[model samples]
Target: MSRTLMSLVVLIVAVYLALCAALFFFQRSLIYFPQPSAVNSADSRLKLAMPDADVWVSTHERVGARALIYFGGNAEDVSRNVPEFAAAFPDYALYFLHYRGFGGSGGSPSEEAIAEDALALFDQVYASHPQIAVVGRSLGSGVAVRLASQRPVQNLILVTPYNSLEEVAVKQYPWVPVKWLLKDRYESGKYAAHLRVPALLLAASDDEVIARDSTQRLLENFPNGVATLKIVPDSGHNSISERREYWRWMGDVLNR
Candidate 1:
């Protein structure tokens, strides 16, 4: 065979092997990320809202208080953040939602499944506490926006949010043809554009995972005055909430 032909054959084989390796090692790419069960606090605030699915939720009760439903990022153990959320909004009843396949929740994770779970959890919280707010961070922002657009959310807060997973996938894998392969289309941009409730959009100026432009786009797409934008200074994707200003803004949003 010609030398060029042999090299072409070797190149194809190498590319094939690389693709297989990526599929094997990055299985989490197939679905939303999941966190292992953490040692929950002995606070005994959690209960199974979805009995068959074993979805665990931690609720902080405050009489006549507005209920806040929290949708955490893909990698976050949402229920584990209950203590912090509880501290942040002492007046509101806080509900930390554990997405499907995370914590004690059963089944696998998908964009639709998480959205469904968010709706169910929202309904559960709304049953007793009529006034409700929704807080979603990163990927959870998609879930929250979808819920808010359809449900009766009094207030909406999004932290380090993105336009969509498809947008992010294209940014990271420019040549991979990810639009076809990506099953989870957590498309917040579309829903956020039309959200009628009061909203707060928090973006980290230096967020690496969810680009600054994506967050900016999502915020800009929001309805006028229906949303307020806060750019957290010197913060990145995971550490945006580490700032004092973030907490201050969060306090103001919840109080509003």
Candidate 2:
């Protein structure tokens, strides 16, 4: 090879390595986009005191045996779901967790930290509401699936869920080594095998974010007859909630 061509090859390799290094160091920032809570009233908030940080839960208190716990998308403000959820599930108490560093919660978010916080929330909720149903959307789906696997949840609902964060990352950055670089891999499929309760995997017919195959892969992970997949017509990943069928399916799952 000519001296000039050798130098050009070296330069290209250096630039590629630098880019990979940057991705490895700051991947979490790209993954989590925290948003402020919409409902900030005292009555609607529940402060959960963890050992390291204080996590906030948007709640609708109802005196009953049933309850629903929700985990929202990476950029979603779970507080926004309060009014609709309250009206839709009148008999069930509702708890929508504001993940660490999201809303007014303290500390940074990671897969492990959020999982611990979820377990704590489930323990607290399960004490009063024996029949607890859990719902997780987008990124929160990973948190919800892992929680249901470990706890005795009555029902599980996953919206626009992926088989694994690593798999999604691989597709997004085909040139980069996502499997090795990713620190917080929310592998929902691995945990789904352990879930014994009934689960509903809700997918959008035109979801632009989470690929349809990813949702199908997660469904395959569950035990036979444990999970069912339903599609909401004419909806995208972010707009799935706007469709009436979405809520109807969720209601059917929670009621069953």
Candidate 3:
């Protein structure tokens, strides 16, 4: 090769490698977008004392055996769901977890750390409310799926869930080596296979964030008859919950 051509080639390779290095080092920032909690009243908040972090849960207390635990999207403030969820499921106690570093929670978030916190939350909630139903939306879907797999959850609800975070990352950054660079691969599909309870997977008809194929792939992982997929009509990924049918479907699963 000519000297000029060789230098250009070297420069291009260096730039590509630098990009890869940057992605590897700062990938979590791309994955998690922490948001502040909106509802932070003393009565509604639950402080979960973890070894590394103090996680906060937005709760609606109800004296009953049934309860619903929610995990929100990466950038979502789960506390925002409080009023609607309280009115919709009045019989069931509601708990919406604000992930580590999200809302008022301390410490950084990772797949493993969030998983541990989820399990802890379940254990605590399950003490009084044995008939626990878990709901996870977007990124929280992965956390909920994994939690249901390990815990004796009564029902599982996944909203706009993908097969795996790695697959989504791969599609998002087609040029980058996402599989190798990803540190927190939330493989919901892998855990879905272990779930024995009833599961409801809610998909948006016009979801641009999570591909339809990704939701389908995750549904395929579940055992036959254990899970069902329902697409909310005329809705997008973030707007799925706005539809009345979305709550209806969720109510059907949780109530059953």
Model 1 misplacement above 4 A: 1-31, 39-52
By TM-score: ranked, best first: 3, 2, 1
lDDT by residue (1-256, candidate 2, tens digit) is 9999999999999999999999999999999998888889999899999999999999999988999999999999999998999888888999999999998999999999999999999999899999999999999999999999999999999999999999889888999989789999999999998888999999999998899999999999999999999999999999999999999999887765
Please give me the total number of clashing residue pairs in predicted model 3: 0
Candidate 3 lDDT, tens digit per residue, 117-178? 99999999999999999999999999999999899999889999999999899888999988
Candidate with better TM-score, 1 vs 2: 2
lDDT score of residue 40 within candidate 3: 85
Clashing pairs in 2: none
Q: What local lDDT does model 1 show for residue 152?
A: 94
* Model 3 residue 41 distance off true place after TM-score fit, in angstroms: 0.9
Model 1 over residues 190-239: C-alpha lDDT tens digits? 99878889898899888889887888788778888788888999998888
In candidate 2, what residue range of length 10 has the lowest lDDT sum?
A: 247-256
How high is the CA lDDT of each candidate model? Answer: 0.80, 0.94, 0.94
Question: Each model's TM-score?
Answer: 0.88, 0.98, 0.99
Backbone Cα, N, C clashes tallied per candidate: 0, 0, 0
